[model samples]
Target: MTTIKGELLEGETETGMAAAAQGGQYGAAAERASEAKRALRLAVASSMVSKVCSIGLQAVSIPLFARVLDTDDFSAMMVYFGVTAWLSLVAIGIWPTVTSIAADDRRRGQLAGVLTVSWVGLSAIFASLIVLVLVLRPVLEQSGINLFSARHYSLFTAALVCYAMLTVLSVGEAVNQGQHRQHVNNLITAAGSILNVVFILLVTYFRPPGEEHVDVTLLFVASQAGFILIRVVNMIGVVVRAGWPHAFPGKAFARELARNSWSLLQAQLAVVFLQQGAVLLCYETDMPRDAALLALLFRANLLLHSFVYMINQPLWPIIHRNMLAGDWQWVIRIYRKLATCYVAYGLLAIIGAAFVGGAAVSLWTAGEYPISNKLATLCAVYFALLVTSAASTPVLMGAKAFVSLGNIGMAEFLAAGVLCTILYFADAVSFPHVVEALIAANAMTALWMMPTQAIVRLSRGSLDAQH
Candidate 1:
């Protein structure tokens, strides 16, 4: 071996050169790894702050709207949004797939093209849903709950449009998640929630006085509409800045997205029904107020669930990466941690609802809609069930168990509807009774999730062994 002039001893030239080259590569890799970790830290921190603020704004929003509108109007408004949520689920087309694909696919520009098609195509679907809603108004009204009249039909239509438009932004956020830039999505969504506060204030100020019971509905819809517009624009700017310069591929990719997105649609609809079906069923009863209260109560429980979900959101990419690496131990450990954390959170939720929930409800409604302890307990139970079931989702998603998960979701939806049916024929038909039925139904679904998750883990391990 010969040495280069100024570098190494004469006999060790090849070894020294090889060692130096190896060291250089190692140093570069370590630097890149360090940078990647720093970025993840920042993303997580930014997401936490944004989620906290979003949760805060959203927490106050339900009760504040209750204060601004009369009981009947408030219920109607909640029902409108609740119904629109179901509609929104129909348009979720391929956004999540777009997120996962974005991580490894270097051609981010292709996704921009896909986003355009998804936006336009999904908008058409959403538009049709609005028409269907209009057409079905008579059907729903005939069912005994006259929730939305022609007076607010346009507002509901407009809100649905805003919601459809928002999916474009959601897909973009998914891209950011895949790209490890979650802070971008989290901050923008946080801004939208903050703007909601402004919209609420405007609705409060612009209301025509005594008719706040009804006219405030316009304000509620308007503020949400505005928030949707702003956030959509925010995401548009993010993509443009990313310079997605790839031209649109042929129709094949778009067709693929459309094909798979239908399953996503099913999954989303199942979730909405699982949570809101009870409330929707309540509308079919003489006590529309109970349906509305369940809706509001559902939203309130979202505040508690928000904590677990926002934290879980950041872990998706991390978990996805680990799963790709065949890190079974890490996956198992994290899943266990998630289950334990939710259990603790669930207990915290029950305590808060048991001790302070009634006082908080009274304060919010000013004795107008006094909540019973039983109702609060059932809501707490429902929430605990939500956490328990949802704990398995991220892991399933990491394992690419969507088809199974989607099937489970559909089964749960049918099961939940059955529970509502029982409520419909039950001897006692009060709100608490309705909620109790829902809690029982939701718990059964939650129980199924653990076994499914275990199956996924076992199947994965066996396959790995065979390979």
Candidate 2:
């Protein structure tokens, strides 16, 4: 009887220990969840404020530019902005890769290496930009692209150089973000927006009210300088406070970053197509009228998309942190909430835009650009898909599923381009048809990407737990 009792007691003790271990894990997970939730809230709130300021400034500047600059100068300025946007992404996958690796390094108390890597990567990218500018400027000027107009080519080149300088320095923001402080970047951006407004106001104040006027070069240079100063200060603060380590990271770490960046570049290029492809399609199809409408519609959609992007910007680091923790359940939970919120917001924005968007556009443009309901709706659907894909980005990026993203994105763009081409040749092309093709193409991408990621992540998490 005593032997049996002793055996029973041993069994009970083992059960109790197991329960305690499980409970300890649950407690730790709950704590992590709480921390993540708080971080996201703060990030979103800051991003919201930043985005509001940006959107407001943009609203102010657009009409201000339209009113002040002549049609040619205004068009040239818009093209200049577009070119700079592409230039800003010249670092491409480097940003995300650095951000993710930086997060991992921080968790392991080894951020110094990643920080050095980021600077090295930025330096290389800056050199490449300089080379490209020198090599491409002559070719582009000879080609007579609208952006390189003889009148403003020199100014544009100077402005681009300034912009490139600032862009390289902006890597600071990526590193800070990985440290779970995206608000630093948001603050920098908000300040830059305010400065841009000031520059615009100055331009408006000094305007000649005719064809000859203050070109965008001064404004661009001023804004870029302001951004650079703010970012440099922030970078210094971050590095100094983090206590820069003396140890140098090995080449393997750099190689790892390079490999990841290459994969990410593919994905980033795919995104560029989705964002800019509509305007190109309109131009190619010879639908100038539709092109104008598409431009307006895209701008309107972009404003709404900006809000989504703002939220996701901060959420990205949080996702990376949880991903590093091997907390798949937490990631999924957050993802579901995020995806649902995005879809709901997209649906509501589409519905709201369908109602007030036309009137709003009319008022904003002072009745210059009138949007039709059909065109507005199609644009909304396309951007909704775009933003949804964007929402899934941090997750795929966290998983380092860059190759899959590239493949799907490539296929999506190709399909859209082919379908649009067929319609154009068949003489059935319209802005609406082009948008519809985009919708179909992106839908395939989203359908494949999101589900597959979830399954793979869940499986991986399960295996991890079992081990």
Candidate 3:
């Protein structure tokens, strides 16, 4: 009896020691994790500051352009900008899809082939889109009544090509971010914005005045050329720092990328449709002046949204890496913190915009056409939704909740369509009314979809992690 009791006591002692050692290791890991989170938070804050500065530059320039240029010129330039944005959607192809794949590949030292294939695939898509745009030029020329002249259209096409190339080059930056090179990505984007501003100033100075002045198309082309150069330089730097892969894309790797990239591509396409499609829809249905006004409101909202995105974008890879490691608890905690921060930031932005945006608009436009109270309200609500929705996006994406993301897109589309249709048929739709409808649709979607999808995915992911 004494021998047996002594043996049992020894076993308990050994188990206790093992547990204590494990506890010490866990405590160390937690400390490290906390430190990493602090570092990431600082990075996110820095990125947001940069985004604000970039957005401010854009906002300041708009009023200057508005002052120097006529409404018709501005309207035509908007169409040109819209077309370029649309073309970029097509040209981007599968590069964004490659981000997670490239990250995973890099972990295994297999990223070269994947990166090569992504580049080649995107380049091919860009070429195809250029050809299609050329073929559709006649159709585009008849798209709006305030269409640009042949010279402008040709210049716009050149801008689109340059924009497409820059977008492709930006994939390298994305890959860099995925590999935890956030500082590099931020620096490159900031530098590009700076260069773009310089080019814009030079173009504005040289351009003719009044109706013949302000060649929007040429300015866009020059800006894009500068942007593309910057991105190419940045991409080269990433390659130099990260070191290129040893092999080109293999057949099996290409197949894997295609399969893995489909969901990301679909998600991206859905987003493009949700955001840009709203502007396009407004342009198609509303008068040119109304479309321009709504565009201005959208741009104002986008400034806040862009800030939210900068806050969230750098955190995506971190969330993805944790999820890939099957760390559901950490995922939940991080997501909760991020969601709270986003909501807080969004609320602050809304309040600030409500109070200060009008004054800023007046100052910028020199009271040329003041932003109305209704428009200000619409901008605030729209920005709130944009920020919150963007904040919740990483959660959905991390959980592979592509279906939920798609449904959110569909809901927004249906809501926007119904609202616009109703407003149109009722003939009750002024610019403010249209803007309100857009904000309502966005808020409705975010309110209904984000929480529901997040909860479901979090629950499922948690269970899966346990298994």
Instruction: Single out the weakest 10-residue window by summed lDDT for candidate 1.
Output: 1-10
lDDT of prediction 1 = 0.67
- Pairs that collide in candidate 1 are none
What would the per-residue lDDT of candidate 1 be over residues 1-467, giving only the tens digit for each residue? 33365455654778888899878866765564464456557776787777787766755666677777776566667777775566556555565666666664455657676666656676777678767877787665455435555555665566666666675456667777777777777787677777887777677767676654436556666557545866678667756855654676577776656665666666776768855666666664656678777776877776677666665665666666656655565567667777788888887878888887787776655556778665677688778777776678777766655666666677667776777677567646667876776676666764676557755774676479448
Question: Least accurate stretch of 10 residues (summed lDDT) in model 2?
Answer: 74-83
Candidate 3: residue 114 Cα off by (Å): 1.2
Candidate ranking (TM-score, best to worst): 2, 3, 1
Model 2 C-alpha lDDT per residue in residues 1-467, reported as the tens digit of each score: 99999999999999999999889877877887787777777777788778887787768866666565655555455445545546656666657766775676543445665566567766787677677867787777777554455677766786667767676666677777776787778888888778777877876687666546566676556545556777778878767765667666677666766676676556556556654555555544555456555555556766787777777776767776676676787777767777787878778878876877677766666565567665666677777776665657667666767676767667776777777778778887666776787788778766557657756765787589668
Going through the candidates in the order shown, the clash numbers are 0, 0, 1
Question: Which candidate tops lDDT?
Answer: 2
lDDT of each: 0.67, 0.68, 0.66
In Å, residue 7's CA in model 2 sits off its true spot by 9.8
Per-model TM-score versus the true fold: 0.83, 0.85, 0.84
Off by over 4 Å in 3: 1-39, 91-96, 135-152, 208-212, 242-244, 248-270, 463-467
- For 310-358, candidate 3 gives per-residue lDDT tens digits of 6566666667766766667887887787778777877887777777767
RMSD per model, one decimal: 5.1, 3.6, 3.9
Selected candidate, larger TM-score, 1 vs 3: 3
